[model samples]
Target: MDSVREQLQIFVRRFGLLNATCCEACCGEDVSLVQSHILFEIRRMGEPSMQQVAEELGIDVTTFSRQVKAMEGDGLVTRRPSERDRRVSLLGLTDEGRRVLVRIDRYMAEKIGQIFSVMTPFEREVTTRSLALFNEALAKVGEAASDGKNIACCN
Candidate 1:
């Protein structure tokens, strides 16, 4: 039997999570997986500040800022100073960004539907539940580690 880590690694590879660029075919833009994720969070959060988005994504502010800058240059995102706080820069998706995100969403939904097509209804439900449980467990682990708990490491 494959270990949990091995299974997750295989899943990530199969899902193209490690791909350098993911949106070229679906959205006609050379958007990296990270950039796509950034776009997604921005849309989901509705004009979140850069620091907020970065924290939500678990990315460092400096690196996330650079990625946002590149996306801004590509005309997919806009950053403007907050009226309430001039120092805070809030992010928004451009019209083109919305179009691209919609296309990517459609593409992903189709892909996921295809993947689930072979599964029985019961299997799909079980799998979805298992994924949610796993995600919750992972988030707890992240919180513990961030709180400076001594998680065991492979030596």
Candidate 2:
């Protein structure tokens, strides 16, 4: 059996590639950079600033700022002054972003379905259990990084 750490690295790298490829096929040129900006900062969370995206990704603010500017050109994301705080521009996914995200979701779902199709029901059940364990372990790691704080899990 693979160690948890090894499997984690493989899972992240593989899924990360899948997402990147989907984004590249959906968008173009700077697709991965633009998609990362959305996937990490906007798609799942409420609108966040270019600054916030930079902080979360451990990148320089200027890098994400320029990336956001490029995405704005492609209509992937929008930046408008927040109603609550005019100084902080709210960064959000545009309709184009939402469409692309949905396509990516479908692509991933189809790919995952193909993987599961070869498995027996018992194998599927075991995979679900393994994923649950992986999630629990990831939550613990996230907590350790942020003083036991964790993200909300709808699941």
**Which number leads on TM-score?**
1
lDDT of 1 at 92: 99
For model 2, residues 1-155, the per-residue Cα lDDT tens digits are 45956975687676665464446654433367345545546876688876676666555667777778888898978999978878888788888777766666676678788889999989999998988997798777766765443443421
| Per-residue C-alpha lDDT of model 1 across residues 52-125, encoded as one tens digit per residue | 99888777899999999999998999999999999999999999889888989989999989999999999999
Error of 2 at 29 (Å): 8.9
User: Which residue pairs of candidate 2 clash?
Assistant: none
Candidate 2: 10-residue stretch with minimal lDDT:
146-155
Question: What's the TM-score of each model vs. the native?
Answer: 0.89, 0.67
lDDT measured at residue 90 in model 2 versus the true structure, 0 to 100: 78
lDDT scores of the candidates, listed in order: 0.87, 0.70
Q: Which stretches of candidate 2 lie over 4 Å from their true place?
A: 12-22, 25-30, 33-41, 50-60, 146-155
Candidate 1: C-alpha RMSD to true structure equals 3.1
